[model samples]
Target: MGRMMLKNWLALLTAVFIGLSLAVISIVPPSPQGLDTPDDQFSSARAMVDVRMIAAAPHPTGSEENAKVRTYLAGQLTALGMDVDISASTLPEKALARLNRWSGQSKTEQPIYNVIGVLPGADRTKPALLLMAHHDTVWASPGSADDTVGIASILEIVRAVNETGQPARDLIVLFTDGEEVGLSGARHFFSENPLRNKVGAVINFEARGGGGTANLFQTSEGNGDAARLFARAVRQPSGNSAATYIYRILPNDTDLTPALKGDYAAYNIANIGKAEYYHSPKIDADALSESTVQHMGSQGLDLTRALLSADGFPRKKPDATFFDLFGLWTVIYAPVWGWAFLGVTLLCYILPLRRDMLRKDTLVGAVKMVGFMVIGGVVLFGLNALSGGGSGADYYDRLAAIPRLEAVAGLTIFAVFFGTFGRSQLSENGVLGATLPLFILAVAGQSIAPTATYFISLTVLLCAIATFIRRSKQTETYGQWISAAVAAILIGYMVSFGHLLMLGVGPDLPSVAILPAALAVLAILPLWRGLPKRVVTVASIASLGLAIAIALWIRLDPIASTVPLY
Candidate 1:
């Protein structure tokens, strides 16, 4: 009984460690400790001054509120010792047509204003780094997170840069209008304006929601040199090449679209948390996350400084393989190096089999584990369809249902894990077997999409090494503790990766999260001597019941006050 109790205690401790790991990775670093030295760097508090005024109302393009925003921006830029230029242009016919389609309006003409400010550098002829954000909000939403954060971040970046003295190259700030309408202001500026010729590179700030990790999502093709600069400059980066690849295929578009068409190096960054508040009427200045604001401003300032000081823009080279390590730092390299990681993990898994002497247990265990992955994935896909994620479900409504959807996903994934693995005890050989499916998947990913798969591949490699260590050690306690620590790190990274994935694609495809969650749980299987089937059953039932309760509550609870008024 005492031994059983000790095992239970260890299990509890392990659970706590995993929780702490997740929390640490998910937190947006708080706004820099104290602003006593505000003059030395970009300050979130100073930036909020602009966010408050700009996000005061729903300032849709061509509205009187938007006009007021334009006036305020011009004055602020002028105060920063910039030569401010405001140009108004009629929205293109295609953009006006889209506006009419989305709003059912019959307006024949729409006007958008573009704001430009220039900070002279020591050298006048050097290609300038263009900083961009759109000032207009959606029709009925304050849009504090949508583009206001971007605009405010740029304003603060400019203020902080001035305090550092002149840059080596010119810094041009572009606050675009009519972004929510259809990137009309950006299209006009990049297509018609003469300033486009002065730009060597571009840094565009944007937001999809009110809070969460600010990610450097998109970069121009041939981002090797550019990504290297970013990795060295940004102190805390929450980005990965996988996301960049995925974003290329997604239908989402931003003001960066028009700019990407030009011969310039471009980077697009955005925060996507508390996504239910996106374009919602409840998005006032107070709703904006101060941590998110700080994250965006700090990363932008760092990258801007780096670009301004460089001899010239990064020369175009092949895309680099990059991802952050536990949100602490970035790891970047050539895609070819992924094979080295894959080869090592393959050897790790293969080497263990020699000791077991081609036993039937290894093969059967591997096949069973593969079955588990397939069954779990299919079940999740089906449940997602039933949980307000069907083909005809309203997109915006699904956005509002995200919290409940997450609960459903959590419960369903746990239930699948219990149902599949509850009855069996995974021996040392069985742990090796479980990694086989992941290894196969990794090879495919490495061959087809190296960047997207490295997170999984590298994670599997670490876990496999932990497994090898567990197998070689005669003492069970040493194996448990050591393997547990490695598992914690692997799980921690996955939790953060999964959160970012959900934020990026949850409304449309939440089931995909099951892959990482299941793999991470399996990575720690060596510690589960035998989680009692009864315990697993009870936990699964309880989680499902709670998930059902949340789903019903979602049906009954009042629509979020933030939901768009329209």
Candidate 2:
């Protein structure tokens, strides 16, 4: 969009975005009980160990491993004097019989066992708090971090409270199975073994990644008594300053949310349920790989740290207004990046394609440069198998390791620039002929596919085009444009792969500055004689680039600890 249209769009979107953001903000489940010092009964951080050890009692999932865990928990809970139940998904004869017995009764079917331990409380009529932690881990990796942590936490808490002779309501410790594969254990338990009315609440301990700050929220959407409990159960100022309480409701639900929300959202659907936390930690078994977070890190936060961290945390906005305002900017400007790209392409197409507009030196240089680039492409192909795809950070690692790349790249760039700086008789065929390499790269299929080599070749070809334009421009000597071109590519490196190198994402790179710097260098004709050509040709590209970078930076970094957000 042009300046006028962009201005209008931003203004309109800002208003709508703010309004919707406010609406979303209001829907999160509010902690009703409010933050209370855990010293009153429960502690700030509790570990569930014994019941976890007990719940590891029977391996109903049929795997010898899961059975071992089940056997461990059952023995532990039985020792605690609570009733124990077992179910298995192992396609075992007994588990099959159990499933066959209940076939027509409910839609949910999973072999699971329930281990319950009761700790008598002060008031018998008071609702019993259901303490829960899943005993299951993913299929491969040890669930130690994903939830051995959670299970152990629950068991320890129950042990402490029970041993202390605490007075209050009863505590029903639940060691759930099949939590890794699905909420199979919990679902079947709830369906088959409905709780008594005295069961007032449930506390599920789930882990995301490495343990840092634990985010708490109600499984039910909208509002409920559970919301109040969360508000109260959460201690203030929290343990980790870096910790973020993602206690706001998003627009969707996870596995556990459906059952809870179905019962809970029944209370306040009109309010359009919201939440601050859901199970979002990445466990190894959930098909997560280092590459999963690494690749997605391109489009998201430090999910690895978020999931795995036990000490660091997600910080909440000091005021809700910040999120509202920032979310508005994101909603409004997200599309503008694509629009900016399209507008530039259209302008490029519309502008008069004039061969005469090119300088004499530029034409000659283009020819030589294109020739060298063709040679480079063939060489790149010949050496193809040496490099792998996925464009992993490994390339950067190896590139940095090689001192030759910097020296060779620098020398080659200069040589090409000097070689193409000038030539007198520039025929149409010769000039058009020079673009063959560039045409191939620009028009090729997406890179990073089976055609990665082709993509690399294309990138080299584009570099040639940059050289052609750089050589043809008479404003500054080829040296200046060449340096700028090199710098532009460096700047591109920072943008395309910059986030990875930053250590991790946060504000530092203005993003805007990168493009303007690169463009000022590449668009050398702007400073030379062809003023109109520079404006329409060079400046057009430069200005458009600057505009895009600014819009994206604004959208991405609306609120900052560094710059004045306004």
Highest TM-score scorer: 1
For residues 151-182, could you state the per-residue lDDT of candidate 2 as single tens digits? 55455445434554553566666777756544
Q: What is the C-alpha local distance difference test score of each model?
A: 0.80, 0.35
lDDT, residue 69, model 2: 76
Lowest lDDT 10-mer window, candidate 2? Answer: 267-276
- Report the error of model 2 at residue 27, Å: 25
On lDDT, the leading prediction is: 1
- Residue 107 displacement (Å), model 2: 19
Tens-place lDDT digits, model 1, residues 41-123: 87888888888999998888878898999999999999999989998899888878766765678899987899999999999
TM-score of decoy 1: 0.94
Query: How do all models score by TM-score?
Result: 0.94, 0.36
The deviation in Å at residue 439 for candidate 1 is 0.3
